[model samples]
Target: MKLECQEKHSEIRNGEIHVYAWFFNRNVYENNTNVITFNKIKSERSGKYTCVARNKAGFDSDAVNIIVTYPPIVWTKDITFNGINRPRIIKCNVSGVPNTYNITWRHYTNNNQLVRVFNNRINGVLILPEGETNDLVFEDSGVYRCNVTNGIPDESGNLWQSKKIQVKVEGKPVLAKPLKSTFIGHFNETSSISLFVLSSSNVTQAEWKAAENRNSLGHGCCSSTVNKTSFNGKCLDMSGYTCVFLIKNTREEDFQNYTVDLINKNGRNTFDISLISSGVPEVPSITDIYQRQNYIVLEWKPTFDGGAPQGFIVQYRKKKDKNWESIRIQSNETNDFVYISKLKPDTEYELRMLAFNRLGNSSFTVQFTTLFKGETKDVWTQFNLFLCIPIVLPVCLFVFLLWYRKVLHDGIVTMTKVWLLDTISIFLVTEMTYIPR
Candidate 1:
């Protein structure tokens, strides 16, 4: 049965139009009580209406009522993609009514392309007792979405509901695990050590640390990551140096370390000295003092640091200057020296060099210096004979003399005289016994 709104012309008529109704399904109908209803109606039929007609009753009147019609909105777009070469669900929603509708699937690609996809109708009204849910899966791991709408509407009639969603996919790294290290040569006997690194990417940092025997020689090598997998460690063993080695990849954010200490011994010493590369500055030594020159050219023995060093840094200042001046030079090995030539001839300059590493530059380092013609004020401050004799030697000698006099002085005198008498008797006997020509 269906109930429809209608217009009435006279007053004394059936209570209302009973065109169609589920409530009026009763077989028996009262004399003038006609009511009708419909399970559904055309959305266009929404509006005011009046029922009319009169039978044996005077003029007919009408009562106006409205048929409310709300339709489900329609949507056409759906589907999207992600950056990882993967698919993902796009955030989307559509406005509509009846809340009960058939949701059809369709795909609208981001490239301004379209494709129609199909899934059986989703009768949320039948599926869910209350609300509706639209869940979608990635089609072949690419991208997709669903279109939703009811079969009818208020104005145009059929409507649609739809939204787009994206899907994603990603792959794993090439190497599954960390690389294992290989131990190279004789640990303690190597005069100089070298390190070689081979990697899948450019290395930014490289350095070595050692600890073994009783003394460990810290690195004195330039630290860098040339990363060829196989390169010289270029480690110089200091005197009495023995230790384990630890290689590091400073290029990495967290940095990866290849530690050999586990196979070696547990030591507290870390030989982390930076080596001088070719052209790199060495410990500065000045020679041939010149009185006429205000500043002296200081040279340092170049370093044979492991990696290529961009250059050397030299710092100096007049003995009276408030600040210091610095100079840089490019280098590649140890034993090379730099002659800082330009200077104020009369002024004394205190010079030093700082070594830079992946960790940062070494502090105001004294590894290098320029020889300066020192003022004669205290030429022998360290070798002052007066200081030793008056302060140290005298005090020590006085102590020894007192100890000697108090302890063995008497015994020494007696023993000496006795020995002298024996010598004299022997001489007398010799004279008496032999008259030689």
Candidate 2:
């Protein structure tokens, strides 16, 4: 609690000093007119108060002796995770001073999301569920923590503890068919990726990444992964795109490989790309790149130019790996809308696509990040400028200054003398005339 002093003063030479004081706690007034009466009360508000009085000579007395107190700790009585209904009870030790302590619980959601459950206190402890001591119950489950604190009554004031509770959320991952790989000549064509995700768990995220510059000697561009919400997964680059994923209902029997082949569509075309993706489709020749939300838009020109395509499919895989896993992404956009979007941030991805026509399908792939942010390079612009002055120039100046000091100490000298010899002997005839003068 805190008190704020508000006093007005006036003087008039009256008889004796008469002091009047009043205290307020919102409407209800208190007659604590005693000059030095105060207690160490635990309140929500405490501040200074005013006392007014006239002296014998009509001088007024000022307010004095303000008091301040600390507020009591807030006690939480219940713990709720995500929602109101309790799912399963978690067994844990329930130990705390029920008289002063309060407990609150935060529950994890079925989809790995965190939510706080609220409840009004019944007894002291957050009304534990059925049988267990501190029988914490949860609807959805995961790792959860509890906040227990001994509020105001705990005179020592330091009373808060959090205990982590691990939950065994019962569920499995759902999965879709893995994509097939493509090959060009003996050099190995770039691989592509495609898939859908469904799960007992909330599989709300998809990702794809590949090793970079992996020739035979191998840099680091061989492995990548993909994640998506039960639909077209991250579009991969044919250049380097291989990875796996597990969704809600994934089981032990699901670990396997999927493969696809590339067949030339139009024999007359130099590189015929047949929609070989699926069903009724001919080969495509030219490919186009476009962008779309969370995916790369890939379309190819029909094998027979001007012919409408049934549909377009993009393919990709991680670079330089034996497994050579593949995934294919589908697109509804026309051949013109070839842009791909929502690739992994700061990643290198390759892409290829097959266009379906009356004859067959044509396939082509390339590599680039879906993100427009170009790769960053090691730039020394700012640091280089600083080093030139503070480090380079100063060191050079010190060297030159030392060299000059050495030259000064070495002591090299040059001198000149004045003397008249043979030229003055010829002028001796002037000596006699000068003596006479």
Candidate achieving the largest TM-score: 2
Query: For model 2, what is the C-alpha lDDT against the true structure?
Result: 0.37
Best by the lDDT measure: 1
CA lDDT of 45 in candidate 2?
A: 31
TM-score each candidate: 0.21, 0.22
What does each candidate score in C-alpha RMSD? 31.6, 24.3
Per-residue lDDT of candidate 2, residues 329-380 (tens digit): 3434443445454455444456555555454455443443333333343467
Question: Please, what is the whole-model Cα lDDT of each candidate in the order they appear?
Answer: 0.38, 0.37
**Candidate 1 lDDT by residue in tens digits, 1-437:** 34333344455245644442121222332233345554665544444444444444333434444444465544433323221322232333444445656665544332323434555655421111111111111122223565566554546554654455553322211111122233322222332334332212222232243322223324332232322110112121111112224333322221222322111111121122322212222333332333334335454543333232434577777666778777776455454344555664334567676554332343445533334553334547645543443455445545645655664545655777666655755554454444323
